[model samples]
Each structure stands twice: as C-alpha cells, then as structure tokens.
Target: MSAPRFGRIGEGPAAPPGGEAFSELLAGGGARVVRIASRGHADAEGAWYDQAEDEFVLLLAGAARLEFAEGTARALAPGDWAVIPARCRHRVAWTDPGRETLWLAVHLPPH
Candidate 1:
C-alpha cells in the first residue's frame, strides 16, 4: 500500500454555518488526524458545539475571545492553545475583522 496523503486545511472553498473545512493528514486503523483553520470576522457569530468529541485548538494568528456555557470567557492570541473537553459547550465570542484569526483545531476521540 502507498503512504497516506495529507491536505491543506484552508486552501479549499469556504464553509457555511456549522461547516468546517479540514484536510485529513493521517488516517489508519487507530486514529484519524486533520488540520482545520477558521477565520472569524468582527461581530461574527459562531456555532455552539455540544458533541462528545474532544477538541484541541491552537491559535495561529490574530486574537479573539472564547465563551463557555459555564459563564467563563478567555482572551486568546497567537501561540495559545486550549483543549475543550468532550460535551463542553463553547463558542467564539469576539474577533477582529481587520485581523483574521487562524486556528488549528484537532478533534479527537474520547479517552
């Protein structure tokens, strides 16, 4: 068999509401991996996630704020990383349109 192929996350067309554009980098009998980047505009509203998948996010550029259902919020910037537990309710609260924020999100199976 040939080696696996990986795709660029943001090179394709943009996605719609709740739509995520991702490129699968690795896949096998064990785990599947992909790269995802989301750019949010100023006053842009985000979708709420309530799934059972765990998410790991790395901020690549710009700045934004993330709000959780527990009434907690966090300001994020480049080089920052956050892990959202499974079934956690969260969304992006704010973003700068002039400066688009790039994020790499990795959705992994539950431990």
Candidate 2:
C-alpha cells in the first residue's frame, strides 16, 4: 500500500498579481478540495459566481467578505466557515489588503 498523503492547509503558492492563487489539494468521489490564496482581490462590479456545485468555504487566515445576490454580505475571519448552495449567486466583496487570506473550499458534485 502507498503511504498516506500529507500536506499543510496554510501553505500555498503566492497569489498572482491582481488575482488569487488556486491549488487543487484533493479530489475523489465527485468532490474537489481547493486552496485559494488571496490578497486584496475582489470581483468586478456586478460580477458574481453562479456555480453548479455546492461549495463549502473555510477561512484559514486573514479576513474576507462575501456578498450574495440577495443584497446581503457576510464577513469572514480566521476559523469562519460557510456552506454555499449550488446555483447561489455570490461574489467576493473584499479581502484583507495588508495580509494574505487563505481559504479552503470544497466543491461537491451536483445532485
């Protein structure tokens, strides 16, 4: 048998200029785990993500804010987590400019 995989959740490549860095950590059984590193990145005005898969996001470092289509926003700090249903319209409203923000996102296949 092969050894179990090992990795750190808080470590990742640097974020790209004016963009976030994404890394796929694991995938199996129609599920994907991604690590996103962001610094001062936000969605363009009126742009939103309408994903077909359900996403569960966990804030691992720094801070951020998520805005939904319903005209509400939720702020996230380290250790905060949220489950976004599939087809939910949402966008990254803000991210910490002075520090790197790390997010662990799990995407589940559509029903």
Candidate 3:
C-alpha cells in the first residue's frame, strides 16, 4: 500500500513559463495520469496528433482551444474537460497567453 500525501495540483514555479511541460502523477495497468502546463503554446500549424490511447483532459486554469480534423472545435475554460478518442486527429489551436494553462490528463487503453 502507498501512503497518501496532500499536495496542490496547480503549484508551480514563479518563473515565466515556456513551452509545454508534463508530469506523470501515476501509471499502471494501462492507464496514466498526468499534469500538463502550457504557456503561449499551440500545436504546429496544420499538425495533428493521432494517439493509440484515449485521453480525457481537464483544464484546471486559464483557457484553451482545440480543433479536430473533422472541422469541429472546442473551447475550454477552467474546470472544463474534453475526451479525445483513440486515433482521433486533433490539434491545439490556442491557449491563453496571458497566464499559464494547467491541464490534468488521463490516458487509457483503447476500448
């Protein structure tokens, strides 16, 4: 058994954030939980990501926008979430540039 420790999910250094960073909180049994931070970040133009696993992502702070190859788009604010199915083509269109955008992501095996 593992002992529990309390910690803040949004606690980060005061330095100016650059690019996107991730921290894996847990990983086992074909599932992974991660915390991600983005500052003035977006996927490369015309680029898409197609992953073998499904991803459920929650926005913890700031805002983000995502566009899919199917021409659908979503805007997320703090406390909002999105699910990306395995093999779905998607890209980040935008993230709040004025502050850090924090995200909690859960990647799971394909159904």
Instruction: Compare the candidates by TM-score and give the number of the best one.
Output: 2
The RMSD (Cα, Å) of candidate 1 is 3.9
Give the range of the ten consecutive residues with the poorest summed lDDT in model 2.
10-19
- What is candidate 3's lDDT per residue for 32-86, written digit by digit as tens? 9988888878899889999999999999998899999999999999989998999
The stretch of ten residues in a row with the least summed lDDT in candidate 1 is 12-21
My TM-score estimates for the predictions, one after another, are: 0.68, 0.94, 0.90
Regarding lDDT, does 1 or 2 come out ahead?
2
Candidate 1 TM-score versus the reference: 0.68
lDDT of 1 by residue, 1-111 (tens): 888655654465443333334555665554456554444532234567675878788877667788887889899888898989989988878654554456777677666
Candidate 2 structure quality by residue, lDDT tens digits, 31-80: 99999999999999799999999999999998999999999999999999
lDDT of 1: 0.66
Which scores higher on lDDT, 2 or 3?
2
Off by over 4 Å in 1: 4-24, 27-34, 42-47
Task: Sort all candidates by lDDT, best to worst.
Answer: 2, 3, 1
Give the whole-model CA lDDT for all candidates, comma-separated.
Answer: 0.66, 0.93, 0.87
For lDDT, the strongest prediction is 2
What's the TM for model 2?
A: 0.94
What is residue 14's positional error in candidate 3, in angstroms? 7.4
